[model samples]
Target: MSIERAFVTQPVPFADALGVLRAAAEESRLRILALLSEGELSVSDLTDILGQSQPRISRHLKLLVEAGLIERHREGAWAFFRLCEGRAGLVDPLIAGLDRQAPPLSEDQARREAVRAQRADAAQSFFARLAPKWDQLRSLHVPETAVEAAVLDVLGPRPVHSLIDLGTGTGRMLALLAPRAGRATGLDSSHAMLSVARANLERLGLARVDLRQGDIHAPPFGRGSFDLVVVHQVLHYLDDPARALREAARLVAPGGRLLVVDFAPHELEFLRESQAHRRLGFAAEQVAGWLADAGLGAVETRDLAPTAQAEHQLTVTLWLAAEALVAAGAERAVA
Candidate 1:
């Protein structure tokens, strides 16, 4: 006798559901909700916590309110938003899904968080003194136009698909090279620096660029993920410049280029302490050796701007190197 077969049902289409769910799935939005779940938050609190523009954060909150996921109340000139208790029917499921898909906080993430907290404190202190006289303070250093031109000359016009800018202070290098790349990620130890970088990029209306906070000696991304990597004016700040260079090399894809721009050897002890710089400067041969140790070839070192006077002189140099890719036939033979 033939038995009747039981029917099995297909799973729900997560792609379609996620599309609708993602309306509030943004990183900033999620963080806002999570924070608000604890208590009410004004726009300024969100700006400080998420390090986002007031307009951008407000837009996300509005979307959440429209979606019936959050409730907002206006008192005088300030507006506060919070997660509605029973009214948040859809938000519960979204939060549950987000919790499941959230990236784990590893040791590196913890370290970065500590660094960010410290940097935020330091930046607040620095800005408290310098914010009012920002123009004057900025003018004390080299002109931004000169720095931009020097960066462009160092990057050249080569096509770069995936790039990383280590210690990407204000993301100047990433902004310059992002147009020539398929994707770009900036890594920095200071959350304040990354915040400035994010704001700068957003002001330019740029997308597909990621900014992460982490140390240069121990970055968070995987090995060999970038087609081109840059460390601009950052080597002098690292405790171990050689180790940081090796870490940068680990992120370079096969045949990818690595460009380092910084000052030549010098004696700048005062700046080293006050600015938290670990080294004064690096030599060309010393940098080349680090690149070779990291499995890179075709190393080229050149000076960009040299000082005219003997006493009043500041020389800049650029070190370029590429990872040597192995042929498929050679790999097969060796295997």
Candidate 2:
């Protein structure tokens, strides 16, 4: 592969490259970087895979992070690390050049899988406890088949460069839209939910998709970063739905679109009480107004109501909005 295609990082100063070289020169640190390129990992996980003391593994991680080769974020009680995006090009080729089948990497990879299996089991247990309730409530809503079809119709056949799903419960939306996006990310507040998403994606072998734990009101991604943003079955759960809508709008790049899926006004009082739903449902006008105020043009709205045979079923509404693409050209002219 060409060097340009190997890593997606921007060029850096000479000192920066020297610093990266120095940081990766060590044995343990090199192994740590190589493993991180595969996926994010925690200190405990690294320790387990390396068969070394926690302190030793952490030291190597600290050095790599200090050199701007990796990034760390706290998820509940655990700290997880991944290669830093800004400097990934520097480390990506280095890690790629390693002999995967030789030395400790082969053995370390086996242990890493074992550690991840244990993690998946714990996360599945949490989901297992909630599965019964989920299944019962799922039947009350419109079938996903109709909703998914509507979403794809609105998006068309062209591939989007980047896609993001807010409140990406179990990563269902990500899986549905993966084929439409060049790279996709699913965000959720619960680590347990993220694990469920990870497992779902892993089963499908969707290496292009990523799952991150983050807030709906304050997502970690940059503004105008995603060409397609989805808010699926999430607004009814938020106390400030307008604020969340604005946040979702902020992520849509120029010429991009946002799709929101939720109940179209219901009298489900029990859902509010039992399911922690803040709003029973939303009116089409209310949602359109929210999208308008967030600087998005109202493209189209569709409703998928149940058939006469299912009076108890809830109707699901979809709203599509687009950000004007003029800014992209203007920015290019200025450059």
Question: What lDDT would each prediction earn against the true structure?
Answer: 0.67, 0.81
Stretches of candidate 2 above 4 Å error?
1-10, 207-210, 324-335
Model 2 clash pairs?
none
My TM-score estimates for the predictions, one after another, are 0.59, 0.88
Which pairs of residues clash in candidate 1, taking residues 3 or more apart in a chain or in different chains? none
Backbone clashes for every candidate come to 0, 0
Best candidate per lDDT, number? 2
Candidate 2 accuracy as lDDT: 0.81
Q: Write the per-residue lDDT of candidate 2 for residues 180-214, one digit (tens) a residue.
A: 56668788999888877876665565633567788
Model 1 ranges off by over 4 Å: 1-144, 309-312, 326-335
Provide the RMSD of all predictions against the true structure, rounded to 1 decimal.
14.4, 4.3
Q: Tell how far residue 55 is off in model 1, in angstroms.
A: 21
